[model samples]
Target: MDEFTSEELLEQLQQLDEQPRIEAKRASEIGKSVMQTICAFANEPGLGGGYLLLGIDEPSSVHESFTVCGVTDADTLLNTLQGNCREQFESPICVKGQVELLDGKKVIRLFVPELAPSAKPCTFKGKFDSKNKRKTGIWRRGLNGDYECSQQELEPLLLAKSGTSYEQIQLADAHWDDLDLSVIALYRTLRSKVRPYAEELQASDAEMLYALNLVRKQQDEWVPNVAGLLLMGKPLALRRLLPSVRVDYVRINGTKWVEDPEHRFATTLDLREPLLRLIPKLEATITDDLPRHFRLKEGDTQRSDEPLLPHKVIREAVVNAVMHRDYQVNQPILVVRYSNRIEIRNAGYSLKPEATLGDMGSKLRNPLIASVLYDLNFAETKGSGIRTMRRLLKQSGLAAPVFVSKVIENEFVATYLLHQLLGEEQLNWLTQFSHLHLTDDEAKALLLTREIGAIDNAGLRAITGLDTLSASQVLGRLHHQYHLIEQGGASSATYYQLAPQLQNDDQLPLFSGEAEASSEPNTSDLGTDTSDLGTDTSDLGTDTSDLNPATDTDLPEKLSQKIEQLTPKARRDKLWPVIVWLCALRPYKAEELATQLSRKETHLKHSHLNVLREQEKLIDYLYPEVINHPSQAYKTTDKGTNWLKHQGIEIE
Candidate 1:
């Protein structure tokens, strides 16, 4: 009576290699790992818990396929699993299990529902080791698998259980002087514009901040909380206290991220001003760099100049980034301006599910920040930002912004393309595929995938105005019938990218005349036949060096020895440095790193790679523009190298 059957779960596992909600194991008896997964399922917030399929062996390295090894004692195994769930934890977890047959082999399908928030941070019944200061028994789901929670990692969970947001916590070290008085005055001015007779405007600075819940009294003195400092903190205070609480505006010279460090960015500006000043500054920075156009209205005497991107759209995007960002994460909000698009990457993922982003309800991660922004007319309280951005972009003849929210990675990226979605140039490109007789929506999906390097159901719906089901159907047709695209991920996480043939074909010039007129060097210019480009190999010299050196063979003796000394149950703090060292050598795909480290790919991604890249800024993506690129990999940045050197590790 589960929403998904064992067959469906198995198919997803086989296709995706792993899924957040599905775990398969050949269980002869209830074990530690099984209990840990159960604990993770029960405690992981927003996961809604997960499924455990017993008697199914995981895919092996050699075969890369899952095998159904039937369980001999399903009843006893089920009893033990249920018993452990009831008796082992701080609060009893009620898990449901049923025996199911798959591939003519018996398996136990158990669904563990997440516990209520108040009952969470579910630790095993054990003695507290105060001297060690370690969180021994609490478990949470990670990209690789269930891992014990570290003290630092448990803070958010503990806060959630107490119904206290990180933003509301009063900073003991922050005094009234930390908040900028000029910024508070600016807030008053903006508030008066929204409501001239607003009650808050009549109060003093301290009273106003208290009214906004920005400050709390401690030892009979008003102290700035996180929201207060974020909204009106002096630049020096912000730098000294919340160093990562700022915006990094980077201008890339071209459409893609350049790999060369010397020429990586054309301009870089870091702003640590208060949110009131920072939001407008960010918008102005982006607008000033954008290309402008002239538009003449009906009965207009003269044409009016306007930025290519609508001002309102830019405002909303900027406001949304700062308003709901997770302050606990020590990373700056990154705004990158490329030749063709603008990307805003923030520390926090959307509190709302990705599927429900444009829906009419708001889910605020930082309610205090959101409330302040709302009062000043900077943001809408009803979650109308996405909807407004889509409408404005559509009216302006621009593509709808694409949003990618990674919950496990704790990151959200909003990408706005500078050009029209299906302009004349794209139409000309579509002419080559006219023989396929694609529908208008299908064509849009294809063009979007090509432009962005990948497309998902949500992204397709955004561009083509299709419902979820219709968009999914169109993607399926492209993936299955036409074979123009291939699938990755599974279920709601599924995405489609152009097939290898189409990807290659799209890169080549469509017409012979165009190919001949191309300025770039070609085989024909080298006195070689154009037809020999694909087949000729004898003249191509071989370079034996590794293109991606994130392998066991490439690991340095120091790092290899360090890794060997670590146990399977080592803390993440101990594991992260090693991961950084391995990636420091060369770019490594998540799978490659997992293989080298003997961990699950998803676990490595969620627990280590993402933390390193997003929060720490020690590592970066090889193909940042296309996050789900086929050959996406991670590389250590200059910051990572410096961090290693600071730790007394020599780098080549």
Candidate 2:
């Protein structure tokens, strides 16, 4: 744990919100509860470490003020705390304690480092688990407070203790004959196609399995392993060893799960075949059921009917689910088909963070499985699968898939949107402003803003294949110049939402039909959201005619009364532009303009007839644009509609 400076420490003490990494206690003396915190800080995975403060009071609310209530006897407290850590805990925990003068009183600060993976689940001597429970000798820090680890939570730790990869672990007493020769032959055929010159294809079946580490010579016997079983085991063998291993293909009627009590799935299919055959079978079943769209490639002579999602994309998604999922969880891979979307949910979070999912190269959780798929040209171990999925979705005119990687639940979910990327309603709405000459990226950004409340750099990167720098430029251009999106946040935290006029949700079409429903929750913010691609730009249209409304204040007031007498409609005509220019320069009373033009009040109504004001535009009340105060005088709009033409700035 990094040591916190005095200022950093003081800021933490004053803050009202509780941080998972910070724990404050008024324990000036050693106590049992303090040890639990120490154990939790050390045992909890992933939050670098935690802090313990001896003399601080917890603030009740954000408005409530707090102060460091400093320890009275620092030496005695330190001695007792150190003794408790050494004697009461199952193991001697290492923590750095410092005595500081806070608010003119002594305060003890302890920084407990996260325990090494091997020595984790730090607990007190009494914290061991019962026989039926998995978590013994483990205390972990959660958001609310410290708690003991559950069985499921402790399994990952035990797997970590093996120091052997999951795929490499030998299946005890399983001999080579348990493997199917036909599966091995099929692998060789696939290897020949992808790696024509590879030497492994020529090796004997048993030798090939041994070379690939699928089968090992244990105690002079060639025994198979978990990877061997998954890739090539017969049906009966797999069922007896790993009954939970299979792909569950569930079809739902609408775009989401069948969450209602009475609602049932459209169809369900459980495939118990070996992964070698299950991969293609699952793809075929889904492709046959998905709606097809006719598309043409660039410079192509003919159009072909393609599924809303590409064939390769579905293959990659399923392959990844099988290749990267945590097989230890004893859960089947769930391939859910909704009316308009398909969701692939499997046990285990992604091998890498959500931010890096699109980047090449990933840490493989099941390299043995990955290697087989990679060798067969069925999947990639280098992380190109996500990039392919994104590109294909965009090419198909479908919204990009959303990948929600939940580390706490150890789950990875891929939501493949089946509906059009830009709905016909949304496109029709944008087509109204062809004059805006918006680029594709800008249009997509607007479309996103129209659906979701806002968009950010991360969102832009997922939708478009833009790098961080490129994404920022697109957002900045639309915000600073085009006036399409309003900017929010500061620096890296900056986000872009549609301008107020563009946020017309009541008109956009709702995303409906067989689109895959997102199994993951929509709880991410701009700072943490990853590839949501779920915004339904249902009702979006901007009144282009009303954009850039202008009311020039300083029109030429010296024009003749006849010129002033021009009707508000006639004032916008080319001939009356001189008077329009004069009125734009300065506000003039209808009577004054009538007198100047040598015309009656009735004539003045025609020439200086407050046309914009009558339309509730150029106002008769306040001169500062109608939305603000408009004066009773016949002033033109300040929003700059025809001000440019009057100044000879506009050619037409």
Candidate 3:
């Protein structure tokens, strides 16, 4: 069974979206109902295995969310499932179950292993023809629910049980002539580059092809096999033999595939070539379509324009798509290129479990094709593909590649986000906390929380490539020392979300009215709504509290020194409490803040003021619905005042 954190499990349930290897049950008791799902999971043909979670209630109302109600009697359910597995089938099913608390409620999750071929077609009462509303023993999991497998679906499993790999099957209709000689020559050239001393380079055509398992002597004639047809077969041969063998490269203009019927893709390049030839072409096509960035290298006066995405990474992805895609599937590999990311969807579920995706060990569906590509220097061996992508993207300051492998969909999609992860904008934002000297791990934790709303120690490990201990340590330091994020959950299920202060800042609008008046989005506007700044500060609610907090005598030593070091824009963070505290006393207009702070109305109103109100939820609007009201004024809430006092900011 694969390892997944409870946080991840909860997240999946909350979304109420079905996962190929995940199922949820909200029942208080375990019976044949739960057993049916287990049978389906174990006998799920090609899907590796699946998990069953009990105690999470599905959404009962449109407005309500999926909630973790937890099992009422966990011990009874666990014992029931264990006893049934022991007594029900011809061979005992191997299932592992445990009780874990979700949102503090005890829930039972079961991991059902895919039964071995010999033990499959897991039936009730040791037979398929059970009459207790269970018509057949052979069951399959589908989009709706588990159902009895029909003859068509059950037939494939019988064939797969014979221990024959798909790629090794001989295509009786295909002859040696179907193989492309040019591709064979290219393979030899690449092999020589990799292993110059190899004697195979000097071998005859038929001998080399035979050695590569491209053509084998079948009875009296040399015939091409599935491997041969895939690695270097002629275009027409593939078109006729494997009609869906092609790559669809689509260029979308926005972040997502356009759903609007009227919108068309920027460009679409469809290539149907032999695997060896298609890879390089596919790599180049995607790279050419990508936007480039300029970087200054050593001894360079001018910036160099290189593809934003690494070419090597692109090659690995395209190669894997062709090499691992299920040719049995009558679907083209769709490479959707949006402006910000590239998505490569192949019609195959990873043979290896999702937990071991990046492990060096591999489970190849087509070893012969893999070997041919290896000799041709097209793709990496084992599972180095994902590791290489991670290393390269990290070096370029981009996100780690994301893999979505679903056995139910029988497809795998790899997403490569083209933008730099923590580029100039994020870097500038982090500088406000430069005083902490945050490590990459800590910074990443904060960034992820900002992006995903929350992150767990397990997710931190996934992103940082760190062990459990290291990830936890980084999370701990951030939570305890810097107090940047707040810890939630307990023990191994622990996760973290951004502290309220940061959450508040994150909620602020990207632009104030005055800031948007400019052509470009400016980060410099660090304070108020400059467009609404009035004449002066005299109308500052007649509150002396603002002047009192601003006085040198009232300021604390540590904070005072930091304020002096920060620029006017940076100072807004520490001084926001003061601003909000003053606003709590009485309603004040934007111009009043400018006068009290002795700062530019444009800077104060455009940058800090709106962020303090919107994100922090500290201040309220005089005309909340009418944001641009002429007489709009601001006042702080009790939550804002309490937060200030909690942070040790005080009124003298």
- Top-lDDT structure, candidate number: 1
lDDT of 3 by residue, 1-652 (tens): 4587655666654432235567777878877678889888988867667888888776676526667888887888898889988888766888988988889999998888998886677777745653543255767775345756655456446656776556767765788888898988887778888998777777898887888777789788778888888888898898778766777666655543432324444555557788778887777777666655556799989876667678888888888888888776555787777655677888788888666788898877777888878776777876798888889989987878766565655677676766554755567678989999999989987876665445665456666777545667788789889999987543322467778888777432211221223232121321222221132112111222332223544445654464456455556566786677667655677777676656687678656675565435567654332233334568765567677788776634
Backbone clashes, each candidate:
3, 60, 13
Q: Kindly list the per-residue Cα lDDT of model 1 for residues 298-375, writing each as its tens digit.
A: 999997767778999999999999987889976678788876678898878787877778899899999899999999
Sorted by TM-score, highest first, which candidate order results? Answer: 1, 2, 3
Instruction: For candidate 2, write residues 1-652 as lDDT tens digits.
Output: 4578544665754431224667778786677678888988887655567788888775556535456778888988988888887887777887888888877888888888887778765667876657757356677764336656666666566666655676777766577777788888888888888888888877888788888878888778788898999999887788777767877666665543423325444555667777899899778777777766555789999977666678988898888888888887655787777655677878787657576888988788888888888888888657788888888878766788866555434567676766665788779878866888988988887776565445666556666766555666777778877788786543223456677777543545545433332222111221222121122100111112212223322223333343546554553443345444434544455555556445576555543353333322332322211111112244444433355455554312
| TM-score, one value per model | 0.80, 0.59, 0.58
Q: Name the regions of candidate 1 deviating beyond 4 angstroms.
A: 15-18, 61-67, 127-135, 259-262, 437-442, 455-652
In terms of lDDT, model 2 sits at 0.64
The lDDT for every candidate, in the order shown, is 0.77, 0.64, 0.68
- Candidate ordering by lDDT (highest first): 1, 3, 2
**Model 2 CA RMSD to the hidden true structure, in angstroms:** 24.9
